[model samples]
Target chain A: AQSVTQLDSQVPVFEEAPVELRCNYSSSVSVYLFWYVQYPNQGLQLLLKYLSGSTLVKGINGFEAEFNKSQTSFHLRKPSVHISDTAEYFCAVSSLGGYQKVTFGTGTKLQVIP
Target chain B: EAGVTQFPSHSVIEKGQTVTLRCDPISGHDNLYWYRRVMGKEIKFLLHFVKESKQDESGMPNNRFLAERTGGTYSTLKVQPAELEDSGVYFCASSQPGRREAFFGQGTRLTVV
Candidate 1:
């Protein structure tokens, strides 16, 4: 079984400021990591994922995440954020291979202010 | 392409009542999944369906919850004798068999009052 932990429950940042959302995981075997964003009253949309290969993975909307195997972390980062970036972000993990159940973190609410 | 969609975006029922939620996965998607998020909790997987066959159902809370996917296209989840703990958003997601990404639906918010 795999579990994901997103440390920050909420992060408030000024518009145009860089931000980092921390995520950590615990799994017995190799796993896949994912980041999803959800707007109010909407479903979650995939932002980025780390399946294999490179440690650094870039995703849509100028967001990126790095998979640090040693630390068991996959942290999402953005150089600069806009007010539109305000949303709830979640980190999830699933075991490698086939279709498996995904475990999600508690979620982090990003509030971008002007 | 049309994304995953769920019917009756919001449903309200009293405790001990019964409610059904529906989901339509993206066309041609072979893997469908059911997940839910209770108040102040993270989303949790309930089950998985590969076509009309259930691949995994370990996450199902109890027998009071029933899920069915007929003809391998759309799926339905039913909660009988719903409890106050069942109040939350139920989400449906789908992906290709080997695809790493799973597309999610808007979800059906079930409120047990």
Candidate 2:
């Protein structure tokens, strides 16, 4: 079984400030990592994914995440945030296989203030 | 292309009542999954369907929950004798073969009183 841990439950940042949401995972086998964001009253949208290759992956909305295999971490980062970036973020992990169930962390609520 | 969609954005029912939630995956997606978040817990997978067949159901909490995807098009999850612990957000997601990311629905918020 795979599990994900999001260290922070909530993070508050001023508009235009940089932010990083920490995530770590535990799994016996190789896994795939993903970051998803859910805006107010909206569905979960894929921020980015790390399937293989380049540890650093860029995503929409100027967000990016670095996959550190040794540290078992996939932290999401943004150089500058906007008020519209306020949302709930989730870190998920899935085993490397067909139709494997994805496991999500407790989630981190990002509040971007003006 | 249309994204995964769930019906009844919010449902409030009394304990011991039955509730049915529906999900319609994308047009060509063959893989459908059901997941839920109870209270402050993380979202957990309930089941997965490949077309009309149930590929996996290990995450289903109990026998009171039944899910069916007829003809591999749309899916329905029926919960009988709902309990307070069952109140949460139920999300539906879909993905096609060779796709790494699963598109998610807005989810249905269920409250049991």
Candidate 3:
């Protein structure tokens, strides 16, 4: 079984300030990590993923995440924020042993205040 | 390359009414999936299909939910006598074989009154 956790339900930050959205997962087997963003009324868009080699992955819209195996975490970060970056971010995990079903986190809504 | 597309972007029906959601996945992608998010909760897996075959449906909530993928093409999920608890955003995703990432649709917002 695989599960994902996003502790913050909502995060408010000032424009140009850095922000972080935390994510953690638990699984008995190897897994793949992903971060997706959904703007208002938009579909879920893939931000980045950590599959094999790199622990740190960069995504679109100036976002990035690091995969920490020992910590069982994949936290998303942005050095600076923009008003257009306000959206709901989801953390997901899928098993590496051909289990296609993905478990998602509750999501964190980022509100960028100007 | 077209992304996954879902029909009836929004629907509102009375309780006990039937509703069917449609999803057209990306071309040549044999893997399709269905998930739902209710009341701002986590997205829950519903089912998965591999070329007209029901690969896994362990996450289906109940028997009232019937999903069909005829001819390995588009898929439809029908809820007979939908209850208020079934109201949520239904998402459709598709990915190619051997790929881990899936592309999602805009989702169908179902409202049961």
Candidate 4:
């Protein structure tokens, strides 16, 4: 069994300020973690993913996430924010092998205020 | 290359009405999947199709939902007598054989009144 949690429903940050969205997961077996961003009226875009090797993975639009196995967490962070960055972010997980279904959190809405 | 495409981006129908949503995935992608996000709920997987065959449909809510992929190219999801609880955004995605990553469509927002 696998599950993901994103405590914050919404996070408001000012322009150019650093922000972090926390995500935690629980899985019985080895897993793959991913973060996706969905803009208004747009599809979910891949922000980043952690399959193996590096614990810290960087993604598009300057968004990066660090995978901490011991803590069972993959938190996304960005040093600066822009108006265009306002969107909903999702954290998803899937078991390591085969064509498994992904489990997703409720998602966090990021409101970047200029 | 074109990304996944879904038709009738938004639809509002009365309860007991039937609706069909369509999807056109990227060319040559063998793995296609469907997911739905109900109001205030997390997105959940509905089903997956490998070409013209149903690979996994354990997430399908009920028999009211029917999915088919003709010739392994385009797919359609038909909902018969949709209920109010069925109102949500339906998403379609496709990936290569390995399932490394999947590309998503904009989603079809269905409102069953």
Question: Can you tell me which runs of candidate 3 are displaced by over 4 Å?
Answer: none
Per-residue lDDT of A1-114 in model 3, one digit per residue for the tens? 899999999999999999999999999999999998999999999999999998999999999999999999999999999999999999999998865989999999999999
For model 2, residues B8-41, the per-residue Cα lDDT tens digits are 9999999999999999999989999999999788
lDDT of 1 by residue, B29-76 (tens): 999999999977889999999999999999999999999999999999
> What are the per-residue Cα lDDT tens digits for candidate 2 across A1-114?
789999899999999999999999999999999999999999999999999999999999999999999999999999999999999999999999756678999999999999
Instruction: Give the winner by DockQ.
Output: 3
Q: Residue-wise lDDT of candidate 1 within A1-114, one digit each (tens)?
A: 788998899999999999999999999999999999998878999999999999999999999999999999999999999999999999999999656778999899999999
In model 2, which runs have C-alpha deviations exceeding 4 angstroms?
Answer: none
Error of 2 at A82 (Å): 0.3
Q: Kindly provide the TM-score of model 1 when superposed on the true structure, using C-alpha atoms.
A: 0.98
DockQ class, candidate 4: high
What is the Å distance of residue A18 in model 2 from its true position?
0.4
Structural similarity to truth (TM-score) of each candidate? 0.98, 0.99, 0.99, 0.98
Docking verdict class for candidate 1? high
Please, what are the lDDT tens digits per residue for candidate 4 over residues A1-114?
A: 889999999999999999999999999998999998999989998899999999999999999999999999999999999999999999999889766578899999999999
Q: Weakest 10 consecutive residues, lDDT, candidate 2 chain B?
A: B93-102
- DockQ of candidate 3 relative to the true structure: 0.90
Give the runs in model 1 whose Cα sits over 4 Å from its true position: none
Number of residue pairs clashing in candidate 3, backbone atoms closer than 3 angstroms, sequence gap of 3 or more or interchain: 0
RMSD of 4: 0.7
Stretches off by above 4 angstroms in model 4 are none
Tens digit per residue, CA lDDT, model 4, B7-113: 88999999999999999999999989999999888999999999999999999999999999999999999999899999999999999888668888999999999
